[model samples]
Target: MGDRKDVRPGVGAPAAEPGRVAYDHHWARDLHSSIRCSAAFLALLFAIDWGTGDLTWWRSALWLTLALLLFLVLCPPRVCAGEGWMASRALLRSRRVRTDLLVSVRTLDGVAQLLVLRDAVGGRVEIDPRVLVNNPDLWYRLDEDARKSAASGCLRSGTDTLRHFSERLERETALTVFRISGLDS
Candidate 1:
């Protein structure tokens, strides 16, 4: 498949009108705020101790603050929110759907998330296929496809309309399909 450009689905098909794709700023803001807040808090605590000339406070708070920062950095409140923005916009812009693909899978709260990148030029975007609709069978099917493709090493990723819609469908029906959260349509 890697040897053939036509291996991508809808290879010869005309591109569809682009969909309205936007990054979840709340997700990004939340991440940035968290990091900022953490750094501010640490600095404040350090100043408090230093000003008071309390070596004991510094020793205790330093370790505690460091530990908390470590935890925050390791497991940020929002998952891919940060990484998506971190991806290169220039690189993503050059990649059109069916021409270049992007895909990622991550498990959260025991639930596996299949994020299929739909567009990255304007901004990084990934649809959690599980969020589509409430069809457990379909979700399973997509999951199976991903797994099998991974196994065979023929997995292709893309940022385009088809991938966007597919992911949207999955996210919308996630709850109904998986008996989980009721998606916000």
Candidate 2:
């Protein structure tokens, strides 16, 4: 109902604690595009069903099911941040970890680069690299947390992987700078 919000740490909303923050797809225009696509599919189907001058129970059921499933699967999670902990929230579940306890950050090969983050306490999360590339502020928050983790004893390994991540970030940053300054094609 109106009392319940789709994502727990919704949008630009702050967390329960004063210093915490949350990020979700609400910030992206993709949310509207997704809804439009689903609606368009059902509308198209409805027009066809009406034009045929025939109505069937199965046809209605199929369209309803299709809309529900698309929204369910495409729904994005909210990434929440605290002083040392970060959490990802979905409609049905949530995952959290102590950012200061980070142990490794490696890129897994897939359709695109998948960054996997692991902590000393066995907390792990795999997310798209585009997430960071798209949101520099989010990347800054994570980078600060990782520095704290490295300073503490909780982070014991994965320097190489961390280095690679920073290198890539730096390369992208430099490219962005050049592009903005009209120095690069």
Candidate 3:
């Protein structure tokens, strides 16, 4: 659907409580590796540029500016799923799609992989798959909504894509569970 409404799912979600899964108030997913790598790389550069000498204040300011800029540019989304829909809030905007009315689910591969969801009502959201992998509650909400959609004939297609996404998430979840149980092979 080409038409969409700027709507949020806060009121309709059960109890309007905080999300039980995939709720990242900060950068959405794990940024530890990225942050560490960036910081370490910057440190190395600073050290190389000013070895055994007092570093210039402007240079320190430059490093701080670089790190802050990197963080702001790479900031992730604020994703939450409600009773019937899911939303991914980015820096200045958010995207919400009705799961129960989902028309299709597909992935676009490029520099990054995005799982795209579309509804008959023209609502759409493109999110990172890791978002679902990290938050089971969001998956549950989407799965439940998709199930209801299928039953209602609102969602007549995209079963394959939906199943693929679901399976990937399930496999990851199982793997995490096994690892936690010390059952990794």
Candidate 4:
């Protein structure tokens, strides 16, 4: 993790050896939010039971279990990308795909938007597009590999999708810069 290099221009992220993996910069903050939410939920449950004089050992145990489940549900996977690969890791497992061998990229639209990438070797990973938009370093790694995939003729789908996504990222980046410079008004 410490060896990861970031190539995003104008950002103050530390540079390291090339070819090292890049990770989601916002992962820690999101993880902390998940923890806080689950803890607050547990506290509320306990407070309600105690206030009603219904708290018991068994019930406490149940509440704790519920809180743990809530945390698991709320937790977000950590996303990382290297020269030719991208991965998503959750509490229990990790999914990796060879970005340089990608065959398809699809955007699933529902309650939450998801970007699904499939590789020539049957590797697949579903990730949130916001992760890329928010972390330019990770996006850079993926974009570079996707280009390789395209050049090698392994990528058969989502060229237009990737182009549109790149445009969107550029727009968002510009907007953020404007906001940071107080020129967004």
Candidate with maximal TM-score: 4
Give Cα distance to truth, residue 33, candidate 4, Å. Answer: 1.0
- List clashing residue pairs in candidate 2: none
Tens digit of per-residue lDDT, candidate 2, span 52-125? 97658888899879887887777666665666777766678877777778987778997767777888888877
Output the number of the lDDT-best candidate.
Answer: 4
- TM-scores of all candidate predictions against the true structure: 0.30, 0.73, 0.68, 0.88
Report residue 183 deviation for candidate 4 (angstroms). Answer: 1.7
- Stretches off by above 4 angstroms in model 1 are 1-13, 54-185
In model 1, how large is the Cα lDDT of residue 87? 25
Candidate 1: lDDT of 182? 42
Q: Number of backbone collisions per candidate, in order?
A: 19, 0, 1, 0
Question: Which candidate would rank higher by TM-score, 1 or 2?
Answer: 2
Q: Which digits, one per residue and each the tens of the lDDT, describe model 4 over residues 154-178? A: 9999999899999999999999999
Q: What's the residue-level lDDT of 84 in candidate 1?
A: 16
Error of 1 at 120 (Å): 21
Residue 180, model 2: Cα distance from true site in angstroms? 3.1
**Candidate 3 per-residue C-alpha lDDT over 1-185 given as tens digits, one digit per residue, 9 for 90 to 100:** 89765545665434444444445443423465556767876787689668968678888888878876776566677788887788888776889998878887888999989989899889889988777877777778888889888888887677787799889888888999999999998
